[model samples]
Target: MLVIGAGLAGTEAAWQVAQAGVRVRLVEMRPVRRSPAHHSGEFAELVCSNSFGALSSDRAAGLLQEELRRLGSLVIGTADQHAVPAGGALAVDRGRYSAALTAALEAHPLVTVERREQSELPGPNQITVLATGPLTADALAEQLRSFTGRDDCHFFDAASPIVEGESIDLGVAFRASRYDKGDADYINCPMDREQYLAFRTALLEAEQADLKDFEAESAHFFEGCLPIEELARRGEDTMRYGPLKPIGLWDPRWGDVNDREVRRANRAYAVVQLRQEDRDGRLWNLVGFQTNLKWGEQKRVLRLIPGLENAAFVRFGVMHRNTFLESPQLLDATLQFRQRSSLLAAGQITGTEGYAAAVAGGWLAGTNAARLARGLDPITLPPTTMVGALTHFVAEAPCGDGRGKGRFQPMPPNFGLLPDLPERIRDKRRRYGAYRDRALTDLATTLEQQGCAARTSSPHGQV
Candidate 1:
């Protein structure tokens, strides 16, 4: 079995295939070929935020993590082992995380890591899994599109900027996470009513990007990670409630909020938080500041922040070419191409967002590919699970079918999409717990029927 691309999805796919007792040739183009967001040649290199998101089980990210654990995800295992001090979020040192993953995959006896670009399509006899994520190289991506026969498959992607921590004036931007949560791990830039209005004006007037031919139509940004500029365009105060929320935490220099409440002299109308980027604490990333603005314009507008007057940019925020298949038109629930059952697609290319969902797709596709390779029956995860819900959503979405399913949109797993609980529990938390409990029990039963344990009971840390 061959897996193209050593990204999160590709790596997970390869690991699962190898675990299924199949030989895998895992191909990576890094060091030999590279993408804009990638700085390392290692597998599972985190391109955007280090945090996989909130760890609370009720949250989408948390529910997905729990599902992955139930299914014995290798990526989640690696992330947990290398986790940093991120409070409720699962953040990691990107360098160490990628290095650990690369080492583990290399040490696997059944898996062979190949450092070469796959510029062409695979022949019919071979069982190949295309987990080539969003930033897939041009030639290979074109080959994939040709094989899939779809034209509606791409959306733009962006990255936030990194700044030198020492250059930021502490006097202007105070160090404190939101609600004083998360161990003072974030630096807050307060925006007074006047300052926020000024910032909004500049952002609204900044030079905008021309839409690509593929992006000429209206497209939606993922709700959780909407671009900062897009948020600004929605309304002047939209961001204040969203990313720029300045709740909890009173600046000591300005006295406590209670002390100032009697007769307020000054107060922050909005705020921007920057998070530490490296262990050395030399750099910080603008949280939720992903953008597609021109580089020169980005510098001009971003510098308007209170503490960033003379900030030194270690790496400016960048926009990448994100592409995804019209899955409703191209793929099945198992991630197999509709026209070619033998060819399976996974990762962001399949239109699911977030690292966890991409890894889930890889696990599903890889397992099915191994089944095909060994002449065993293919298995599909039940739609009750987060992984299964994501898979089923893509396959059944009624977009581009000339039916009433509206426009095709990539989705992250949410409770709204999951099956309703048998009994209605009005409380959201209790309801989610019931859903999770039911999903796990079903998954265990399914795995047992197939003579497989969702996870091994052995002490092996390798997933």
Candidate 2:
């Protein structure tokens, strides 16, 4: 068995193949060559935020992580072992996490790590797993183009900013979760009407980072990860309705502040949320505030938030082009290439977003590849499960919007992709919890029917 690339998906695929008693050739071009987004020769380098989203099974990402852990995922296990203190998120110390993964892969006798550039397709008889991921090199990408017989569809992805936790003014910002449902895991900077308008105005006027690879007009940016300035341009109130929505939060310290500051007695007109970025709670990321603003302008404009007036930034936001395959038209639910049964693609390149989603693709692809090597029928997990829903969506969702030219971008895990329950449940959390229950039970049944292990490892997270 062969797995190309040593990223999260590639590493997981190699591990799975090795666990299946197969000798695997894991190809990685790092150290010898590099992608624009990666910094080290390490396997599973996380260029984005360290978080893997919420850790409870009631949420979509959390449920997906739960599923992967039950399947004995190396990436998820290593993440838990190196976890940082991200309030409700499964964040890790990136340095330690990547190091652990590299060491494990190197120690595996069934796995052989080869560091070189793989710019072309493998030979006819070779059963290969293409997990090169989104930051694929130009030559390999062109090779993929020939194999798929279609242009690889892609979008721009952005990373949110991280601020020094202590720099935020407590008198101006308050810690709270929406509706206080969970722990006070988020820091909120409130904005009144004037303040919100001013902030929006500045954001609109701020300069965007220049891009040389793709023209602005031809730039294919994911709608969910659009730059803050782009949202500001859409409308004066767009930011408020989106990221800045002040609903369900009330500031207790508002009355103690000077009345002359024009602070609202109730909820503010807009709010900026900062989520804990590390285990120690020293760093906080600006939630939903991914941007392409120039560095100097980012500091100047971000400070406009009431609580962030004196904020010290740990890291400014950055934007990168996220590449993906036109999966809906090219691949199946098992992530197998429709044209070639022996080859498969996984990770971000397959149009699945987020860490867990990428891992799910790797899990499915690796499992099927092992089955094929053993001369058994490959499995497509039932759509009721999170992994199945996401993989099926990638394979079946319409590439075109009704008007006819909108291509399949990327998809994150969410209940919207799951098959609806027989009975409607009005309460959102309860509804999601019910969905989680059904998926897990259904997953167990599917695994048993396929004669796979019911429990590979105790899950690192909970429902």
Candidate 3:
């Protein structure tokens, strides 16, 4: 068995294959060749936020984490071990988590860690798992493009900027969720009309970073992950309608709630949300503010928003090339290429977004690759499960052109992706809880029927 790339998906895939008693060769091109976003050769390095999203079981991300735990996922298990204290979420010390994963993979006797680049696809008989993530090198990306027979196999993805929490003017910024829903998890920076207009003006006039030759040639940004400046260009009110809308949010410092008119008059024209990036609330990322602005411009323009005037930047927003397959037309739920069963793909490259979703793809592809090696039939998780719903969606979603030329986009896990409950439950919390319950029950039954239920034992213990 062979696996390419040592990212979250690749590391998890190699671990599963080796654990299945299959000798696997894992190749990584990091120090030898690094992506624009990456800063190290470490395996599973987190280039974006440290967070893995909400931790409530009824939530999509939380439920997926539970499922991975039940299936004994290495990536999630390692994350759990090195986890920092992120309230109601699983976040890790990025450096520690990556180092631990790299050490674990290197120590595995059945796993051969190779430090080099793979410019081409492996032979048909190799039974390869192509876990190379979104930042696939040009040579290999072109090879994949040819194999998939598609001209548009890539898109631009952006990362939001992080700011030091201490530098934020807490006196001006307030912590609250829209309509006071759930916990007061987000930091809100209220902006009146004058402030909003000024900020918009700054964003419009900001200097942007230059794209590489390849990226510049085909500058297509994914609709789901558009840059902040791109949204500004859409319309004067576009940013307000999208990320900066101020509906259902109220800051107590505005006035006494007893005076309804006074409260109503103080409503912000727009609001900038900041999500906590670390356990200690030391780092906060500007929500929905992904951008390609140059470093100086980012500091100059972003600080114009209230509360961020004296903000210290931890990391500036960046835009980079993200390559992915049109999985709806090319892959089966088992993650195997329809045209070449021996070759499997996983992670963001397979059109699945989010860190947990990437790990789910790795689990399926790795397990199936090992099964094939052992002369056993590969298996797919029940579609009722989050993992199953995601894999199935990628493989079976309709393509725009009947023959699969366009119209497939990357998907993040959500309750909507799961099959509806047998009976209606209008309460969102109950409905989500029902979905979680059904998924776990169905997953257990499927594993038992397939004679693989005992594989739930985790090397890092239960997550």
Stretches > 4 Å off in candidate 3: 155-320, 402-406, 454-463
53-99 per-residue lDDT for model 2 (tens digits)? 98888988888888888777899889989999898889999999999
Query: Please, what is the whole-model Cα lDDT of each candidate in the order they appear?
Result: 0.76, 0.81, 0.83
TM-scores for the candidates: 0.65, 0.69, 0.68
Clashing pairs in 3: none
lDDT of 1 by residue, 270-295 (tens): 88888764334555778778776777
Q: At residue 156, what lDDT does model 2 achieve?
A: 47
lDDT (Cα) of model 3: 0.83
Better of 1 and 3 by TM-score: 3
- Report lDDT (Cα) of residue 269, candidate 3: 93
Candidate 3 colliding pairs, count? 0
Question: Which candidate comes out best when scored by lDDT?
Answer: 3
